[model samples]
Target chain A: MKDIIIRGATIRRELFFFLLSFIIAFGMNLYAIITFKTLWAELLTQLPFLILVTLVIYLIILLARIVFLGINKLLRIKKNKSSV
Target chain B: MNSPYKSRRAFIKKTIIGSTVLMSYPWLEALANESAISMSAANKVRVGIIGTGSRGQGLLYNLLAIETSHNIEIAAICDNYEPNYQKAIELTHGKAKAFYDYRELLDIKDIDAIVIATPLHQHAHIAIDAMNADKQVFCEKSMARTLADTKRMANTHYETGKILQIGHQRLFDKKYLDAIDYVRSGKIGNVTQIRAYWHRNNDWRRPVPEGKPELERKINWRLYKEYSCGLMTELASHQIQVANWVKDAQAVSVIGVGGINYWKDGREVYDNVALIYSYADGTQFIYDSMTSNRFYGLEEQILGDKGTFELEQNKMYSENPPQPAGILQLVNNIEKNIFEKIPIGGATWIPETALEYKGEYITGDFDVNETGISLEVFVDSVRRGKPTPGLFEQGYHASVWTLLGQQAMETQQKIYLPEELKI
Candidate 1:
């Protein structure tokens, strides 16, 4: 199972993955909106906070990815230095 | 595979990360424990609030907000603090008489229930007295500042026929309630351990009073251990209660380390503390409170085998990807979307072209509220005499959170629940 692993995935495929997730999420959101009357009201009322949360979550994911990549690079450099 | 120093650094980072993830579990943890079963009823149960301070005010606010908080009315208000007493009177539109002594407040004619939101030391005495006085009571968290007091309080609660609810309100929050369902439903798998934390900046900001020596300390009693349990009662108890709610079990034993590193203003309670509680099921609930930082506001986490739910900053959410993105998925999305509109309808009807992917973030507010939901339910239970999600045991459970921490601090050794202690 460990040998069966694959870490590298390309950008388009990532987009495809994102789209798939978003679809599932949106569908669930729609379902929630239908079932819960308050969701509709909240979307209308607390729209600003809603937008802010979305922006923040987006930034977080981006920042997290950058930091993760940076850390990975730092580890690689440290490894090379130790080898030398 | 790794260098010695590198491994050491990695180990330290991993340890920190692991602890962090553990601490993150209870934020959306134990959905307010749902035991909304019926209790035998009595009509016209009048309720009074002692220590009409912040908590008293907050409860009043909740009571007013709740749609159907039944026949019970605030018969009286008591507070050593004149401002709080006056405020409650104003909130009640002066409908309720203000009393300086809680004894007077508790003795209000025909009063059947009392809300004791006074300082920690007063909790055991006031609650036991009120119960003995034949009134149902809701005392604030960290039931008592002392183990002796807790033993007495618990005993009194059991001995008395009157209902006693402790002011551990998270048992009422909807997010916690929903999360508990997930936990019980085994969504996050079998919950073995839970963690909680409360981090805040500023020096407990209890105002340094001018000239009024005795009264201010008596009223703003949380700053001193003689009258209060310090942060153990004031802050840690809140998170500890949350851990209890998450575990759905009373703490069996606890060990903790506490240090008053931040606030140096003649306070006895540890300014920073960490406590670990064990349950009968071999589960552990851990808590930490540090006043020097608000890097993390407030949250608790319940951990299970499959995944962990992160309830933090009042939003109960979960994140786990044992495999962040499977190989096929990673290729299908990562490769194709960046390359072309290449409909990868190979072998499987993968809707690659159909949906556009979001890389930055596709986000929405998960309406997982923590505080308000429970407050509403508590009020509804009182008003309609309907089954309440958070009832008497929640109070006891919360008290146990405080007591466990207190004992750990006192003995410098782990404290265990009494043999009789049970949910």
Candidate 2:
């Protein structure tokens, strides 16, 4: 029995990822805005910088995930049986 | 092995560079220095008072005293009610011109700012007009009656780039500032829950002149749904504002129950309201406002895993258990079956103080009154020509949350902050 090799770039998956990222990013931005009481206009002015930072963080997080996954595979540590 | 090491090194370098770049951003520098810009007083800031009711008169008194320290003058006064207008004029010692219409006062060319202490419903319109007239505004809290009105007032403030200070005095209180600092510094740990309540025994009504059933509602506008939200908007706002400040987050949803169980004297608003407002992080602000009981006068308790902050008392209690007194320990042990056969007889058991005193006053002796500090800040901000950052948002959140809580009570369901006003 072979596992199906599914591409990660499917439209549905892409959309889901985009929504998830947006929701997380926007939620954080909203919190900062509420907490600091920064005007929306001021926030929008910093959007470019904020977007860059978000992308950098996302990339770093993705790299860390890949690193952890690789390390897990090397250890041959079975995932908890209950999860499957 | 080399590739992984290189990857790790690259990650660390990127993080350092990213942080440096973020720190060097000019906008952040601007934010830091935003309120530091000061102005030399060319002359006095000519101020106008609108709505000369009890709240209006009280603010007028503060403003009058503030004039001695700050460069401000009461240039004009306005009120719909004749008696109030006359009373405000008397306070000014006939220095300020009286007007029946607020628009007439706004038309005064020399007026630099307007202090609006009108009923909750009238706040938006007066503030908007004043801002349009290039006048700085200090409007009383529960900023406006409706969501749209509150949004409009804030939008107008942003558009005009005018100094718009909502009358939430706690923002300027040294004690509150220090207490909030303590919370933010994680001294009390993450605030998981906040409980606030304001209780009073009176019916919250102002006596009207006889032979005026129509004027009863007008005089006691706080009891009417169209004008005010009774205890929620009137009293709960201050505590709710404090709760938001402690959590550093706005409530995402609110579930409430309220009733006109007592003092039903033809009033439209509820006499009692209990609301649980949940923030995005699942922290809840449990708030209650009642008119029939004065037992628990007022309090805002910020509860965390490490400790609890009682804002009313300005005290903190540690979560760590205290060492039990020897006699109390003996009594407890006997009760728990530790000494089942031992005879334990007592005259009446006196309750011991549960927690030891770890909470200390965050404020110093020279701390100014909250309202006075608020006025000083407002006057200073007006002089500087820069509106204080976060002031509008504080008022906006408190107002929006109060209205949301009211909606929850009226509908008997949980109500969320509207998506449009989420930020």
Candidate number with greatest TM-score: 2
Candidate 1 regions with alpha-carbon error over 4 angstroms? A1-84, B1-44, B66-69, B313-390, B420-423
- How does chain A of candidate 2 score by TM-score against the true chain A? 0.55
How high is the lDDT of residue B143 in model 1? 77
Best model per lDDT = 2
Residue lDDT tens for model 2, B1-423? 132222332332333243433223222222223342223366578889999999899988877865744557888999988789889989999999999999999998878889998888999999999999999999899799988888898889889999778888776454565566667667789889999999999988888888877788779999998999888889999988988978778888999999999997889999999999999999999999898999999998989888887777767677874443332333345467854554477645556756545666554432345565566567766776778777778888998998888889999998988878754
Score residue B272 of candidate 1 by CA lDDT. 87
Whole-model Cα lDDT of every candidate shown, in order = 0.63, 0.76
Q: Candidate 1 lDDT, tens digit per residue, B243-299?
A: 776776677788998878868877776788888888889998878888899988777
The share of true interface contacts that also appear in candidate 2 amounts to: 0.00
Say which docking band candidate 1 falls in.
Answer: incorrect
TM-score of 1: 0.63
Candidate 2 Cα deviation (angstroms), residue B180: 0.9
User: Which lDDT tens digits does candidate 2 get at residues A1-84?
Assistant: 999876867666645655556556555666655655655553565556556545645665668778998998866655555356
